[model samples]
Target: MTTTSLPIVSTCGTTGCSYNHDSDCHAGAITVTQGCGTYVDVAGEAGIDTRAQVGACHRSECVHNTALECGADSVAIGPSGGVADCLTFATA
Candidate 1:
């Protein structure tokens, strides 16, 4: 039987997230780094365009895991190993 692929969605629910653009996380495929923190926090105002300082991908089991691109619909970002960021995340 042929199976259809379901749409994947992610969202950055952090208090002050900089990876969100119009409620969308445009940050490329993120990977985990050797350091403790895997993300760079941006300071300014909410709903404003901010930059996501590349860090690392805590989710090692992500389906879009690759050396070049993140095939997953979105990525969860937050503390190391925590669900948070995404590329195709939509706001509810």
Candidate 2:
């Protein structure tokens, strides 16, 4: 099988996360975007483009967080308790 390197999974620091396997995201796909729990369409702040490119994550408590980007090969989102949380969040 051929693999494309477009979307890379960010390392998850949430041990409570399901997709987190030894600080690595095995979901193979993840969504990266700003704004959590609620909408923040405030003025002054530039609007961010929300796309599922497994690009970067907004989670700060994650270990694999570098410049807000995921380092995993890929990650899986959804089936969350509420918002689309990183299934690979492990605590430091």
Candidate 3:
């Protein structure tokens, strides 16, 4: 599979963010928590493998979170998950 680098947004300093430290998203999987009442995937671009490339959520309203930590009950990959700005993210 061709590996393509997707443009990642910085993780916002909102509570419950995954990319809080060094923006090191190595999970290769992403899912939006339920409490935020929304779902967003940071890995779904062409040539980008969401299951093989780790990513971080920049959305502050994500339900799967609690102070920059992934609090989601489950995580999955799909095409609906788009990119967003992480208000708390910074370049490593």
TM-score of 1: 0.35
lDDT of 1 by residue, 1-92 (tens): 11122122244444344545554444442343322132345774333233332333343454544442334433444433343434332222
Global lDDT of model 2: 0.46
Estimated TM-score for each candidate: 0.35, 0.42, 0.28
Candidate 3, residues 1-92, lDDT tens digits: the string is 11244223223222233332333333344433322222233344222322222233444455543454443323333222233222222232
RMSD of each: 9.1, 11.2, 14.0
TM-score of 2: 0.42
Tens-digit lDDT track of model 2 for 1-92? 12354454444443444444554554444545431222222333222332224644677667766777665555544334544455555558
Residue 83's lDDT in candidate 1? 35
> Could you say which candidate leads in TM-score?
2
The lDDT, on a scale of 0 to 1, for candidate 3 is 0.32
Q: Over 4 Å off in model 2, which ranges?
A: 1-52
Give stretches of model 1 more than 4 Å off. 1-9, 19-38, 46-61, 78-92
- Comparing candidate 1 with candidate 2, which one achieves the higher TM-score? 2
